[model samples]
Target: MWLILNIVVVFWMLIGVLCLQVPPSEFWPAGFVAFSLPVPLVLNFLFLIYWALRRSWLLVLPFAGLILGWTYYARLFAINLGQEIPKEAKTLQVLSFNTHIFNAYDGKQRTASGVSEEMVDWIATHPADVFCLQEFYNNRNTGGYNTAKRIGVRHNKEMYFSIGEFGRKYGDIGIAIFSKHPIIDKGAIHFTKKESINRGVWADIVLEGDTIRIYAVHLQSMSIRAADIENTYSAIGNEESFKKESRNLARRLKRGFIARAVQVEQLLEHVRKSPYPVIVCGDFNDIPFSYTYNQLAAELQNSFVQAGNGIGSTYNGILPFLRIDNQFHSEGLKAYNYETHYEMGLSDHFPISATYVLEPKPEEER
Candidate 1:
């Protein structure tokens, strides 16, 4: 009994430590759940120990833990939770993704992976009204068959592409927006990027007898390297050496923090200037709490949080745990269906898709 009690307490301590790594943004619903899912299990173990120790009153520890957990995230939950239910209207679905720099992924390395085919198949299964793709590539011509054109042709939908860094030796990154709706006016925003990032794409799409603007972007990556992430592991081999390595990581994160802030600000300016209600989706490449996600998700609400039942992480290929891919929309649009295409098996980033119903335009302002 004494041993069991000690073990359960140790479990709580470990779980508490795990909660510290997630960004402050998900600290609400998604972050809270990530931080709290182990509580119930830990408490169950404690309950059994209490039974043996004859300390029935000790159950209060578990109860208190629950309260603490909720209290920690209550404000974030409240601020984000919807109060006025969105009215129903014809729903239009969209999918967006950044295909990464290689134009190929799916564990295949540099080999020519069938990413285009797989993407088309995935879209056929999901059936989005609009589709957006980033990190685009052309075939043998260095500008041959684009992934967007193929997908659009497969569905017989109009493909709208606003190119960025095109006709360069290796800087062909661009945004592709495809829609069943008639694409009216299309434009692209060129974001300041030292990393050669593709700029944001905007298209006025006609849907369900109404037109709404959709902007898809692949913001400046945090410029974090795989070595930096791997170095985060405990300094197993050489404590002093690992400490020095980790310090370098901290410095890199700081630089990245500043760059990401500037990029998010630029992106937000574009979002705020949209002439019509908008749906914004992309691989933000930053965590929920950082200035990138905070600035981008300011007024625009997250679709995965609004409608997705579980933690809807879109960067599926790299690590199944992080939720960097996101969808945000204006108040008039309600994300009815939200999903992460976790099984596409191509691209380091997973695709995020959502179906939204547009409410009647608000009478107050433009």
Candidate 2:
């Protein structure tokens, strides 16, 4: 019985490993399956402990599973002991946050909120060279708060946005880049998929001696409606409603997975054509183990996996364990001192920041 159970557990872990390689388009279930990558790791650890307590050599099964799935585990969590902070001349601090429209729109109702003011104040205190915001609202004078302008003024940086299709109805809905450096060039990649938030924007900023292209992207969200969420929590224990909400949530997740896959292909193409060194940051709206994340990770270095320690979860929703927000950079740059600024809970997502520096060119190149 023990052998049979352990074998099943090991096989499940292997399936999780396969999820890393399989694209969502090839097998849609893989998209949903990848989210449970951490589960197998935790279960294997517990099984290893169970076998060890019994002084059984069968512990090798779960141990080998851990060894095999180590890369996925490493991506989820890191322990950095000797990570050092960069010096003033070398350091470039960048921040990425999804403001969730400052929590201003609740369903059909749109009312003013102090969330934007508080976020501006927060940014003022914890300064960064560049601020990349998704679901940014910019309503000047009409709704009483122009978030982008306010943040730009507070930080004294120029702001660029990928204005959404909704236009100014809910405040220029889109992604924005606020940079302290002088932006020489800027553009936006308007996604074909019709999502209000799915868009990418880039700004070429002139630093000390080189140009750095910063991309602010907001991928397809899991379009789980407020009613779906509220029903999930409020109507718990009611089996019929619970199952209905769960199904809707799952459908949204699957759609988001496929949509993000398409969006990432566009993002990768844009990254490939970049003339300057690149730093891409934003709310991915997906987990670390998903196909969307793996595609991006293949092209660039992930800042959190490089410099962050422990579980660097950034999403502040019911399941706060999801690190949907990420920071990635091109090969020419190095990221250090990555952190999730959980101090201000003004939005559904937490802000993440990282200090980066240009890698010294090889002697022959110079």
Candidate 3:
């Protein structure tokens, strides 16, 4: 019986690893399986321990499963010994955050009057050389807070703001990129869905002697409200209510997976054609184990895996372990001091920042 259970667990672990390779567009269920990978990972570890204690050959099954999924494990957790950046290297500090519209709305209602201003002040004072903000808000109305104006003034940087269709309909809120370096060019990747609040924007900035493109992206969100979570939790004891709530949540997740699959393909198309080295920063709205992260990581280096320590979870909502925010860079750059700013609790998502230095060109290439 124990061996049978161990075999099942190992099979489940393999499926979780397979989820990384399968596109959610091709198989939506793979997204959900990938999101729950941590569960099987823990279970397989336990089985490995159990079999090893008994000196049973069964240990090999769990061991092989873990070895197969090691890359995904590293994506979710890291233990870097740390490295020193050379003092002479010119570094660029980049910060990516989903501001949740600066806490303007708490659920369906507006938050306290002064809350948005306070959050804006905190961000404006932060010392990052470039800021990639999702759910960024800007208003030009009299007496309204103009977030871009405030932060741009503080950084004194060239700014690019792309207001999506949804942002245009609901108070000029979208994604923004602000850089201390001069922006030589700027553009946006408009998703096929016209009403999507999520979008991608980029700026080509000349830093030191080279030009690098910075991409700020916000992918499709699950649209799972706090109320949906609350309802699901409250309905736990009642089987019928629980089933209904679970279905509702699952439907939202499915929609998000499908939408983001399409959206990411659009973003990748832009990424592949870029003439300059790229640094992508944003709220991906999907875990590192999903297709979205894998597709990007295939082409770029993930900063968290390179420089971060521990399970670098960036979401600060009801979900406990979610590292949906990320910074990915081309091989020409090296990332250092990647941090998830848990200290700043002003938004549903915490801000993440990293320092990067361009790699020295090879003598042959030079």
Most accurate candidate by TM-score: 3
Clashes of 2: 0
The predictions' CA RMSDs to the true structure, in order, are 7.1, 2.5, 2.3
lDDT for 134 in candidate 2 is 89
Between prediction 2 and prediction 3, which has the larger TM-score?
3
Name the candidate, 1 or 3, with the larger TM-score value: 3
- The best-first sequence of candidates by lDDT reads 3, 2, 1
**lDDT, candidate 1, 1-366, per-residue tens:** 754665565465445435434333334223333334444445544565665477676556555554555522221222333334355557888888776643543354443344365555565456788887777653433333345545677678887766664553333446778888899888877765333554778899887668889988876665656666677665548889788877786666555555555656677788788878899887777655445665565678878767765556566443455677788898778876677777774677888887888876656335
Report the lDDT tens digits of candidate 2 across residue range 1-366.
877887887788788767867777668898877877777778888888999999999999888987887777788788876877645545689999888887767756765554467776676556799889888877775534767666787568898877784544555668888888899999988778455668889999988878899999998887766677887887689999889888888888889888888889899999999998899999888888888898899889999998899899998877758899999999879988899988978888899999998876687247
Q: Model 2 reaches what TM-score against the true structure?
A: 0.91
| lDDT, each prediction | 0.64, 0.82, 0.85
Identify the leading candidate in terms of lDDT: 3
Ranked by lDDT, the better of candidates 2 and 3 is 3
lDDT of 3 by residue, 1-366 (tens): 988988887788788778877888889999999877888888888999999999998899989987987887798689877588978886889999999887765567633343478778778888999999998877654235777878896568779989863333235678989888999999989886574558899999888988889999999897888899999999999999999999999999999888888888899999999999899999999888788888899989999999999999998888788899999999789999999999888898999999999877797247
Can you tell me which runs of candidate 2 are displaced by over 4 Å?
86-89, 113-115, 142-144, 165-170, 193-195, 225-242, 364-366
Provide TM-scores for the models: 0.70, 0.91, 0.93
